[model samples]
Target: MATEFEMKEIKSGDPEAARHSSMAAPQKSVTVKFENLNYSVSIKAKKTVTEKVILNNVSGMFKPGKFTAIMGNSGSGKTSLLNAGAVKGGKISGDLIINGEKMDTKFMKKMSAFVMQDDVILGTMTVREAITMSALLRLPPEIPKSEKLDRVDEIISMLRLDKAQNTVIGSTRVKGVSGGERKRTGNLIIFKIPAMAMEMVTNPSIILLDEPTSGLDSFTAYSVCTTLSDLAEQGRTVVATIHQPSSDIFLIFDDLLLLSEGRVAYYGPSSAVIDYFTKIDYPFPDYVNPADFIFMHILNNSEEAKQADKKKDALNKVLLEWDNSENKKVMLNTPATQKGLPADVMKVNASFYEQFRFLLTRAGKNVWRNALMVRARLGQAVFLGILLGLVYRDVSSRPLKSQTQALGIFLASVFEDVQVALFLAPMLIMPMMVFSGFLINNNNIPVYFNWIKYLSPIKYGFTAAAKNEFQGLVMTDQFGSLTGEKVLDDLAFTDELPVDQNLYVLLSMFIILIGMAYMALWRATKKVV
Candidate 1:
């Protein structure tokens, strides 16, 4: 029987063997090297500008088939160094070499994926739904739907989320899946790749993570790291910015990159770290967690370190000690570069129409599953319609005819939250009712300030409804004949819009409002950073 790594080698060399292996296994790998990488931002204070350095001259290498951990004390520029790979509105100068050849930002972006610390999955979706939606959007177009689904199933099984596949990842309002399952469900792949379960991850050749285990518990943290290690073992280079790890979790890491005050304190194998530090007079004692031991010494110089400067500037001495160490001589020797990457890497598999259909299907599913919200909305419509008829048993007696209900839909798109629309809807609609020919006759308004009614959607909707109900009717009861035309004249509506014109105006308002909303959201997404 061959080991897993050996089996991966076999699959890569032989097409026949590849067909039988797990599809989630990495198909390619690349070395990620950055030399003298620096990231800074300009801070203006009191008529003077100063450059605040986040990462200062940091250099390191993460090789293929290695689970490298980038750990440091809080505010030590761990996230800054990791994010330097994908510079977003920041002043960054660095040499990023992939497989020993310097690559541009465009090429670097296509080759790697960054997984943030947050697990942001829709609480309404099931585990399978979340993963399948990603798979449908990404994964190569050549692969059949049936095969893509099969790969999704394999990923579900690998993460041991088979039982929770159909469970809803619930929010704080409602109880649903377990915390661990919720975390795992959120780990779906983000970029264009096979929907491999990343759990706050994306499928890219070089995976850089910023604190994958931040909010997780001891056992869950270990489990998350184990999955990362599995990905590394499958030949992909994995880099993660991790915090205080348990001894067991630390042991899972192949290489360790330690930093202090924006400088590389040590960069080498995890096992050799003890010897590396011991040679510099910082000896590690037995029967203590290696992570805790390291943090105790290094974090002593950090800003928040309790009683900092117990000794004279421990940070500078430790950093200087590393500058003269033999480990500093180690350099990134990237493997031979590939002529080209896989065609399906980060490539969209479906056409626009197909993607739209899938998105529509998902929208339908979300609406169906949110039964409470749907039922509440339906109940409101039925209850309100009946109440309106009761209050105004006769149509002519009704006081309100609001057409701005569609404004809620418009507002929802603009605010990007339904609750905001719901809260602000009544406040806006009440003014339209009072000012739009409902409270007093239009002709009785002040001459200088009488133009507000034209802004009211209620003005047109009410006129249209009244014309539709009593346009040709004539009523007489021991009084002069009251024709519908006479009623309109008395209400100062004879010069108002005709029924057909009012109907058209309302329709046009709805369309224009909705179109503006769509444009607002589309523009918001155009921002790259």
Candidate 2:
């Protein structure tokens, strides 16, 4: 199994230390297994909170040297289960035993690369740069830099991305790598922006992807799956959530985990699924594609439900059949144990200067390359500034504008607080929903909590929006012309701060939030060295 990317270590001529380091010194094989994993989230609506169950009693194992696909119709908790295995955290309860130890976000982040479905790698860098920079940042520093770059080159070759090495992970706006090449980087691309797609270049032994093949051609999707298969060959635990793959793409996955209504309907080898379904009384026709047949005939909760409603009883029966079958026993009976490499492989090794230099360079490039961002932001400022200028320019006239100012840095710092923002970002932003003004009147809130309105950027932004929409103008009706001032007074916006004050608040908050974000990142990088 030794290749250009791997090397033999000779440490004091000691066999035990070499065994502990495993393959070499940086990357080691990982086995991730979980059982009784139940995940749910509390969703708040108009006036009530409800728990939405995503994964129920889901038990599965993604072993090293296996390309596993978790497939189900929309809302089958495929993404949920993958995130669980990634240990990104949710209202999840289970034993996620990695290398025979129950790990946390810190350790998992060290040993795994999670490519979310959206907002993947930075779109500005070239394919080689993305992978190379990721290696420089995440690989153990004890290894020489040249060897790290060599490993990156090996990965690029494995992914067949060497031909597209210089290509920019482009977006719909910027010309860059092809869709297939982007997906092949072993990362997720949202079809609009090109992703760095070099999640594999890190020391992370485990890789979790959500729809890496989404938005690609059938051949490209198959090719991406094949790249994952190659990673399995390299002894990495590869797990991804795929949707409605073609027969060829389906054939590429060594194992399959099918879910329906937050429950495990099937979990086993991809080739065995047809036999399993056939044995459960749902016969597969000779010419029909098993995937399509399973979706329409077996899973009543699938997006493509036809007579699936009538098949609800039948779906329950199928679930029961799988639950009671020996396949479930085999899946649960797989030994949950393994040998782990040294702890150095489970930590990011980079100097603060290195991280800052890379980040600043990336940001500078992003700003320089993306002229539209600057131009659009300038256009918005000009328009909003002119709008307020045309108004009486009263200190009490306009109000809160949230998204344009400090929200990103504020939310980023908050997300960094928890260290895992996969699902936590939205969860952290839940307070915004309550404070958004339109959802609840500021007056109705209790006096002790009423001061929070001062902190709610939505209040100020909505006031400005309301003022811009209704102030200084008149509405004409069949009865008479009503002054916009009357409408503003009626909405109680007259009591709020004016355009000038709102700008000051947002500007100050933006400045402060930026400082906070900088400190948060600085402290984080301060430890890496």
Top candidate on TM-score is 1
Looking at model 1, report the run of 10 residues with the lowest lDDT sum.
1-10
Poorly placed runs, candidate 2 (over 4 Å): 1-26, 186-196, 302-309, 340-342, 373-513, 519-529
TM-score for candidate 2: 0.66
Evaluated at residue 432, the lDDT of candidate 1 is 56
Please, what are the lDDT tens digits per residue for candidate 1 over residues 391-510? 444434211221232232222223332333464587775555566664667888777647767766777776666555556767555544567676666667778778899879878877
- Please provide, for model 2 over 370-410, each residue's C-alpha lDDT reduced to its tens digit, 9 standing for 90 to 100: 76887897897797567545443333322232222223323
lDDT of 2 at 72: 85
Q: How many backbone clashes does every candidate have? A: 2, 10
TM-score of each: 0.76, 0.66
Clashing pairs in 2: 170-194, 395-498, 396-498, 397-498, 398-499, 399-460, 399-464, 400-460, 400-461, 401-461
